[model samples]
Target: MDRNAKFIAALKRLQGVAPIQVWPATVKSIQGTNCTVDILNTDLIDVDEVNLRADDEATEGVLIVPRVGSLVYVGAVENAVDNLFVCQVSEVDRVEVKIGNSLVTIDKDQVKAVRDKCELTLSDKATLKQDQTTIELSSGKVKINNSATSLKSVLDDLTSLLQNFTVTCAAPGSPSAPFPATITQVTQLSTKINQLLS
Candidate 1:
């Protein structure tokens, strides 16, 4: 046994161990969970569509799809044939989750939900602005505040109408005492007018 022969045998044993291979790739197209990627810096192999690895929480969480032209990691066992997978997405544009039939999307600007119904509650003040506003209520009643000027105008119009109107009545059982019966009608009208003022 020589030292050089022993070294060569050790080198051969090391070479027999399989290694993991990873390469940077660009996503070409995506269909469902399968993706086609172009491996960079390699011309020895050509890979077609590879199955994308779903995250562990994919059952109840989101599965992000790598967009075309985005970078990703392609992994394979060394010396193995036809076993390549899209390991992870190097660039993420958005994250989307599916809940029942609804889809929730989150991006840089906003978080939006596509569902049948949604409710929002604000702890602080909320301000809404528009050029014109219209509110429809189930009940057909609406209440409005009367300004002092408008109330005064209404009272003045009522007073003018009452002053110009005259009421006539027939004497009750006695033509000689007609003035007394008419005086009672006038007193009743005065009492009604007092009620309006209050």
Candidate 2:
């Protein structure tokens, strides 16, 4: 073929393999994993059924659903107008993240988590506050309701006082001391408390 005809043939071959394109858009609606968006700053117009971004293979990673009327960045693969997908969003209505058996969900109202166990480890301290009440954990100590007393310490003091309990006998007919049954019950109570709190 002539040089000019060969050049034209090459251009035709590259026409369908163009670079990806990204456009700013406004979300119009959402259904399942797809949404329609109005492409901004150009005459490109609205695109329908564009895929939303999924963090993982669409089934096991983060999923963010943008609110309607929110701004987003939509990407088109190979510059194809019909192969568009959401790449980034400005505002989200909900977000969900799942990895293995753990899952976390966040929405406008609340955040929820599901897992076998959860643990928070801190270097110095941690506190949970609500209005005037507070629970603080620091230096291997726990303070509840802004008080210095701990449940285990209170139980220990009570057990110690009961174990050493005594009574004054002002009259000869009065009982010499507490009943033997009372002492036995106190010992059993102490044992149970230790088992529960240990």
lDDT of 2 at 136: 62
Q: Estimate, for each residue in 73-176, the C-alpha lDDT of model 2 and write its tens digit.
A: 99988887878989999999988777887777778765666555542323356655433445568888886542333455556767776777766576999767
Q: What is the C-alpha lDDT of each candidate?
A: 0.58, 0.73
- Candidate 2 TM-score to native: 0.50
Top of the candidates by lDDT: 2
State residue 150's C-alpha deviation in candidate 2, in Å.
19
Residues 22-98 of candidate 1 have per-residue lDDT tens digits of: 78888888766567788888773346656664443355556667877898888775645366777788776566777
Off by over 4 Å in 1: 1-20, 44-46, 55-60, 77-81, 99-102, 107-110, 114-198
What shift in Å separates residue 198 of candidate 2 from its native position after superposition? Answer: 8.0
How many clashes does the backbone of model 1 have? Answer: 0
